[model samples]
Target: MGNKPLALTALSVALGLIAGCAANSSTTSKAAPADSGEKAAATAKISPNKPKNDYNITVNYELGMHCTGFDFTYCCVLPPYNSVQSQVIKTATGPKKYPELLEADEEDHSVVVDDDAGKRFKLSYGFVDNTYSEGSKLAYWNVPYDVDGDGKYEKNENVANAYWTHLYVYEGLKGANPKGTSKDSEKLFVGLQIPVPLDNGPAGAAVPSPMKGGHLHYSGEKGTIVYTKSPVLDNVPIVLTNPGIWDALGLPLTPFDDSLVRTNPLTLTEDLVRPFQETFVSLVDADSGKPVIDSHSGKPITFVGTSPIDVPNCSRCHSNETANGKKYTLYKQERA
Candidate 1:
């Protein structure tokens, strides 16, 4: 069972190599017989399969917080977070897949593409169906708390607070921000903002629930830039008034304030039903500032990858089915 994944991966690579070889063979010129009609027919069949572009993109992502505790009162629970990295290669350039060749003096094998086209190219990621906002289980879980530090948990529209304490808090040990004075310290902080009220109990009576969408600002060498994720478009184009953030971050600054490189909506779920999130990445043409489309698919040259979220099933150990059968009331109350 442990080796199944490795075996499957090896099989996939082999299949991809076979498909690539077949495609290449069809596109290459072959010695034909004297019958010109036969040669023409063969060429026609292969032309449809030939790729229009020689560019390829690879995407990868990692979950910043794998598992988040649901009950913040009992333990420290973290918000959802993930980071994505990607690279692009123009295969027609040379035998090497990477854009730049390794320098003779360079000790490391890391290759960086410093060309103007590479610099202008921008990458953006977003979810196809964002399940973190309204009517979702995650939103229901983001309850209000006693922000004022009173003994009683805060209530919204007569609904007693179930989870969450502070609106926004620092991410480090004991929620301490060591570089709080520094301009770049915003990224180190994590908090939820409630822009809209949530339906807690009675009809027409709404309370200030956690809004899972907001502008995330982080400082760069030039200045601070804003990245927004809403219930509509999660992690799509970044919006920033300052062009310095774009130049400093190596992304193109267009009039629309968004990288034209669009991604198909990622539909992977991040709740108990799926517990995984997917993101797509595509490249932008340096000259046209448009998405590089795949010739075969006639769509954007996209690479999709998934990030795992460990949504703990606390009931497995905390329910009434435990060995001693002494039900933990705190855990039971959460489920209720």
Candidate 2:
């Protein structure tokens, strides 16, 4: 299959430089100063900051993909720039119509949109109602990434004003006990995104757990950035009229799964997941020694862990047919 992502990101150098202050072990971290500048500085101390180095950010979708994106499983790594068709969805219902913005040919894919949004970046997975667990290449049909204006890919920091997406998963004392001089988990998500820059950090900013047993940073995992994107990241508003996002949420456009989606209180399992930790993501500008948690451009972000939501019982044909159904069927999470 593919390699999953973990949350053990850290920086090689101490935060004293970025903190704009000293590392005072005796001084307990207090509420950040009201001033944004002061807050940014303190964020570097105990909390995670924008990355200056790469943590070898990597993500691969497609459950048990022998390689990257998707494989014979789920749906063949949706052709790059191809939008899922809509007309062929006569028999389908709910979100996603077969594969909107999926095929290169708009007529073939049967979509009214232009190039597929996930074409350039080649995401690891989508989070709509259909293919929630179809972790192949994230179908970022609407995720805007053209940031630098250099006619190239753009990371959040690359933009003049990039919005940060903060994730929070609560954990009580489990995260309070720190025995070593290691860094906090705030930058974990940033590191996960920018692995290349932060790879040289302590403990290699490793992902503590790489299993399917528990949450990555479950209830005891506290506030730590787990994932982030450039510009607006993944804070796209959901428009029910728009079926693209519906498809992204595992809509089961065709006669898809009708079983009760397992949505517990766990973050990973809360919804259909393609095993983000197992994906292989690529870094942008690495080898230049750029840090993963850089305050120069990014702000202090937060990410918390939670439980997976129970899978919804809504299929295309409105019947119980597993994922991919009579077509292929995937072992990933079945959302709707």
Candidate 3:
């Protein structure tokens, strides 16, 4: 949970491979500079099935949003979190009561105002640096959670989201190069969960007690993500988990995109893997590539979001392998 330091290491290696060289057999690419964010993203490996090639390979890192088909929930009960302590409020009658209130007042902590009822809310915050994987991309996500889900989510309180929005990019390369080997091995930045206010300021303060709130809260369309080129990026998977991942693409979120229920990012399902069939099948061979046919009938696979294949997934077969790996982690896709 306190793994933010590792992200720098991974980012260092990723950037090296990217700016240096592909995993060519003749000579290794020169390493990146001591201070560069791009150096952090260059650490990746060729898929096990990838075939070696000379010169740069033309592939598309189709940074799209897809579901993990795995969703679970846990409760974040309120804590006597001492961190949320804030400045005392001077009412017309007198100062406030309660040990918790006194603690907040003494600390001069800014109160979070509730969006629904416009009520004053107190909260607690804490920071945890997390590492996780997305496809082949090894990423570090700075996950700060409101340990005391007592409506306390902030950085000024020295706290962060229940998950992570800040992501560190890493690049991966192939072969046993220590720079590549160690970097790639240490590259994985795993699952990061971040929940937060609308902006730098707190949004949900002093929420109603005995209130009914969803366990995993996500403000739809609030998620966005950014992308860049990298060597560690070869077989990275595409998932839509970044807090701002969906919005950053500038993709349309109309009813037209999600009408099929299965195609809906809101209601993604594996049963509808058919929606990605053409793209998937195209990764097979031109001869092996089959049209999206119906499971019930032998007709072509037809549905929304269907289109011809292109780079990224398609170019890899001859160059590397199929783009079938874990999801890509968050890069800096949104502004602070």
The top-ranked prediction according to lDDT is: 1
Q: Write candidate 3's Cα lDDT for 1-336 as tens digits.
A: 000121244543433343232344332345577777555435454322111111111112143332233346653432111101111111111122101111111122223222222233322121111011111111111334444355764452223333222321233211112343333333322112222222211112211111111011111222212222256563233333332110111111111112234222444433322222111011111123334232334554222122211222322232222232334323224233
Per-candidate Cα lDDT values, in order, are 0.33, 0.23, 0.23
Model 3, poorest ten-residue lDDT window?
277-286
Q: Residue 140 in model 3: shift from native, Å?
A: 20
| lDDT tens readout by residue for model 1, 1-336 | 000121244543443342352354345544667766555333432432222344444444433344546666687654333333344444323222222211111121112232423333444444334323322233332445543455654444111222322222233112234455323335321122322234221100111112122111112222322233346642222322231111111111111101222332233222223444554555554446577666566888656666454545634434544523554355455545
Stronger candidate by lDDT (1 vs 3):
1
Q: Candidate 3 at 147: error in angstroms?
A: 5.4
Task: Please give the lDDT score for candidate 3.
Answer: 0.23
lDDT, candidate 3, residue 293?
A: 33
TM-score of 2: 0.18
Alpha-carbon runs more than 4 Å astray in model 2: 1-137, 140-144, 147-151, 154-336
Over 137-185, each residue of candidate 2 has an lDDT whose tens digit, in order, gives 2223223444324576544332111121231111211232233322235
Candidate 1: the clashing residue pairs are 128-265, 128-266
In candidate 3, how many Å is residue 150 off? 5.1
Candidate RMSDs in Å, in order, are 16.7, 26.7, 28.1
